[model samples]
Target: MDLEVVEGLVTAIRPAANPTDDGAVLLPGLVDLHTHLREPGGEAQETLITGGAAAAAGGFTDVFAMANTEPVTDSVERVEWLRAHAPGDGAARIHPVAAITVGLDGDALTAMEALASAGVTLFSDDGRCVDRADLMREALHRAHRTGTVIAQHAQLADLAGNGQINAGRAARATGLPPWPASAEAAIIARDAVLAAETGGSLHVCHVSTAASVDVIRWAKSRGWPVTAEVTPHHLILTDASADSADPVNKVNPPLRGQDDVRSLRRALVDGTIDAIATDHAPHTRQSKQRPWIDAPFGMTGLETALGVVVRALLEEDALDWQLLARVMSTRPAQIGRLGPASGRLPQTGAVADFVLVEERSPVRVDPSRHLSRSKNSPFGGLELPCRVLRTVVGGRVAFEA
Candidate 1:
C-alpha cells in the first residue's frame, strides 16, 4: 500500500503486496462528539496541544471540542481562532463546537450563521442546561437554518443541584442528594418535542438514564431528528461505586445503578443509542483528590473508551464490530457534520483516519500512562482483552502502542 503525506495531510491507499497476514482489525478512527479540551482557558487542567495528543493516542482521528472553555467559544472570531489554532501534529482532528448562547449563559443566543460559516458544526450549552424554553426553541430554530446540531447536556438545574450521585439507595446511603433520572429524561423529552416542532437536529449528550433512552427511542419511532449518547462510565460503572467515596467515580449525569447500566447496554446493542461519546472532562490531580462532594465531576476517558466497550459489550457478544464502528465513528461523524476531510473512514479518496486493534491483546488501564494531562479515570488498573495498537490520521501514524 502507498501512504503519502501532502501538505501535512496523510493519505493511505492500496499497498503493493502483503508481507505478513497478521490479523489486525481495521476500523475507522474513533470520533468523540463531546470533549472538553479546556483550551483558550482552563489550560492548567488541559490544553489543546495536550488534549489533541491524548485524543490521537486514544485512536481518535477527530474530536468535537465542547465550547465550555474559559473564555467560552460563542463568536465567529473565537470559533475561527480555535479552528486555526488546533494542534496540527495531534493524531485527531479537532472541530470546535460553538456555544449556543453568549458565554453559555442561556440568556442571549449566539450568531448561528456566522459560527457555522466559521466551521462550527455543533452548538451546545454544555456544563449547564439551557433552562429557558423559549431560548432553547430559538436556538434550535437557528441551528436548523444553519444545518448545525444542538447538543444538550440534559441536566435540570433545579433537580440536579448539588447532586453527588444518582438518586437511589446508594445516594440515600451516602446522605447525598440524588440526581433524579427524571432530571435528564424531562429535558430530553422536552427537547425532542422542540426538535420535532422546529425540524432541527437535537442530540442528547452523555445520556445516563434508562428513561432518557426510552425517550430517544420513542422520538426515533416518530422520525424526529434526535440522537443520544452513552458514556463508558455509565455503561460499566454504577452509583454503587460512589459508596467508596472515590472521586474517580464522580461525574455529571452521575454513574447510575446496575439496572440503568444494563438498560443502557441493551440500548446500545439495539441501536436505541446513536453513539458512544467520552465527555472527556479532565481535571488536575489536586482537584480530584478532595472529598467526594468537593471534587470535580469528570474523568479522562479517550484512551479507555474502546477497551471499556470491548470488555463490557464485545466479550459478551452484545455488540459486534459493525455496531462498534457505527457508535464510535460513523454516527458521531454524521452528527458533528465533520465530512470525510476530517477523517470519517479509510476509503480510497477519504482521509486515512483509522485505528489498528490487536483484537486479542490484553490491556491494563493506567491513568499515569495516559497521554491526557489529567489522570482521573475510574477504570485505571482494570484489564481488558483488546488494545488499540496504532492510530493513523491522514495516513500518518499519530499513535502506536
Candidate 2:
C-alpha cells in the first residue's frame, strides 16, 4: 500500500507498483484516553515533550493528558498553557483534559462551559474521584450541556481509605491494607445511574476488577451513556504481581486477581469494554525508591502499552489487528470527541497519522531506554512483541526505528 501525502494530509491511497513483502503492518495511529504528563510541579516526573516522545515511540498519534498537575488544570489559563507548550515538530497531539472540580478538591465544579469553549473535551478529577454524589450528578448534567465527557477515576475514598493493594490473597499475604473491588464498583454503579439520569457521557478509567466490568456491562446493556477503558497493566498483570513487596506494582484501582484479568480480557474482546487507555502515570525514581507504603501509585506506560496489549490479547486468538485498532484508536478517538469519526483509516483527505509495526520475537522491556523522564515502569523485564517500526503524525515522522 502507498499513501500519497501533501501538506500533512493523505491525498490518496494507491497500490504500490512493486510492494515489498515485509511482515510489517501499517495501522492507524493509536489514541490514549488516559495519560499523565506531569508537568508544572511534577516536571521531575514527566513533561509534555518527554511524554509526547514516549507516545510517539509507542505508535500513538494522540493522547488525552490528565489534569492532575501541580497547579491543577482547572482553569482556562492552565489549559492554554498546556496547549502552548505542546511539542509541534513531530510529536503526538496532546489534548489537555480539564479538571472537573476546582483544585480537584471535589468541593465545587470548575468553569466547565468556559473550559469546553477553550476546546477541552474531557473532564476529570483523576487520581482523585469526585466522591460527592451531588457534585458528580451536577457535573454530568453540565457536561451533557457542553457536549463533553465526564471521566471518573471510580474510587470511593471512604471505602478505599488507605488501601495499599488489591483486597485478596495478595493483600492477605503481604499484610497490606486491602482495597476492595466494591470501592471501584460502587462508584461506577452510582455514576452509571447518574449518567443515565442526566443523559451525560460517562467514561470509566482503568477498569481493574471483574465486578467493575460487570457493572460496566450492565450499564451498557441498559444503553446508557457509559463507556469504559482498561489499561494494559490491568489486562495483563494480576494482584499477585503485587504479592512481592514491589512498589512498581502499586497503582490506583490496584491490580486485581487472575479471575479479574480474565474477565477484563473477555470484556474487551466481547465489546463490553470500549477502549484501551494507558493511564500512563509516571513517578520519580526517588519517590518510588521509598518504602512500598510511601511510594506513589503509578507506572509509566506510553512507551510499552502496545507491546503489552499485544502480548495480553494475542494469546487468546481474540485480537486481530482490526480489533486492536478499534480499542486503541477508533473507540478512544470517538470517546475523546476528537472528531465525529476521528480514527479513520488512511484515505483521501485524511490526516496522515499512522504507524508501521512488525511482529517480532518477544523483547524484554527496559525502562532505561524510555523517552519519558521517569522510569517507574511495571513491565520491566517482561517480554512483549509487536515492535513499532515507525510512527507518523501529520505526515511527518515522529519516530523511526
Candidate 3:
C-alpha cells in the first residue's frame, strides 16, 4: 500500500490488478471533528507531532484540535499562532477549535467574528459547559453571523457534581456522586432552542446520552442546523469500565449503559448523529494513574478509534461503508469546512487522502505501540475485527502497519 503526495495533495495510488487488502481497501481519509492535541502546554500528555501521528495511524487526514489547552484558544492571535505551530510533516492535518468564551469562563464571549476570519470553523468551551443560557444565545447568534458552529460540552456543573461514572449502576456500586443523564440532556435541550432561534449551527460534542439523541432528532426534524458527534469509547465501552477500577476509563460525559449505546448506534445509523469524532484527549500516565475521581477526563483515542467503530457498527451490519465514510470523513470535512483537500473520497482525480482498512484481520490494541505521548486508552488490549493498515494523505503513505 503505497502512494505519492506532492505539496500536500495525493496524486496517485499505484494501482494493482484486483488489489486485495494486501493492496488496499481505499476509503476516504478519516476526519475527527473533536481531537485534543494538547500542545501549547501539556506536552507531556501530547504534542502536535505525536498526536498527529496517532491520528494518521487511525487513518485520519484531518483532526480538529480542541482549544482546552494551557491558554484557551479564544482570540484571533491564538488561532494564527496555533496554525504557525502545527506540525509540518505529520500525516494528519490540524484544525484548531477556538473557545466560545474567554478563558471558557462561561461569561464573556470571545472575538468570534475575528477568530472566524482567522480560519476557525468550530468554536467550543469543550472541557467545561457554557453554563449561562444568555451567553450561549449570544454565542449562537455570533456563530450564525460568522458562518461557524458553536460546539458545547453539555454538562450542567450542578448535575455532574463529583460524579465518577454513569449515574445508575456504576455510580451506585462505586458510591461516587452521580452524573445524571439529565445533566447532559438539559443543556442540549436549551441549546437546541437557542441554535434554532439564532439560526446558528450547534454541534454537540461527545454526545453520550439517549435523551440527547432524542433532542438531536427533534432539532433535525425542525430543520435546525444541529449536529452531534459520538466518540468510539462511548460507542464501545460503558460504565462497566468502572468495574475494572481503571482511571483510563474516566472520561468527561462518562460512559453510559447499554441502552444508551443502542440509542447512539441507531442515531448514528439513522443520521441523527452527524459524525464520529475521537475526542482524542491525551493524558500522561501519572495523571491517569490517580484515583478515578481525581484523574483527568479523557483518554488517547486517535489510534484506536476506527477499530472500535468497526467492531461496534460495521461487524453487526448496523451500517454500511458509505455511512462509515460519512461519519468518519465526509460529514466532518463538511462541518470543518475542509473542502476536498482532506476528506475527499478515493477515485480518479480525488484528493489522494484515503485509508486502507483490512476487514478480515483482527488485532489487539497495543498502547505501547501508540504514537501518542499518552498510553491511556480504554481500548487497550482489546481486539477488534478490523484494522487500519495504512493511512494515505495527498498520495503519501502517512501510516502503515
Clashes of 2: 0
Error of 2 at 147 (Å): 0.5
Clash number for model 1?
4
lDDT of 1 by residue, 114-200 (tens): 888877889998898998989989888988898999999899887778788888787888887788999999989999999999998
Task: Tell me each candidate's TM-score.
Answer: 0.94, 0.97, 0.94
List model 2 lDDT by residue over 1-401, tens digit each.
87778888889888886788764777888999999999878888999999999999999999999999989999999999999999996799999999999999989999999999999999999999999999999999999999999999999988999999999798899999999999999999999999999999999999999999999999999999999999999989898889887899999989999999999999999999999999999998989988889999999899899999999988777768898999999999999999953686777887788888887656789999999999999988888987898998988999997
For model 1, the local distance difference test gives: 0.86
Error of 3 at 228 (Å): 0.4
Which 10 consecutive residues of model 1 have the lowest summed lDDT? 1-10
Report the alpha-carbon TM-score of model 2 versus the true structure.
0.97
Q: Give all candidate RMSDs, comma-separated.
A: 2.3, 1.3, 2.2
Candidate 3 lDDT over 262-347, as tens digits, reads 89998888999999999888888898888877888888888888889888886457757788888998999988888755566665
Q: Give me the displacement of residue 111 in model 1, in angstroms.
A: 1.2
How much lDDT does each candidate structure score?
Answer: 0.86, 0.92, 0.86
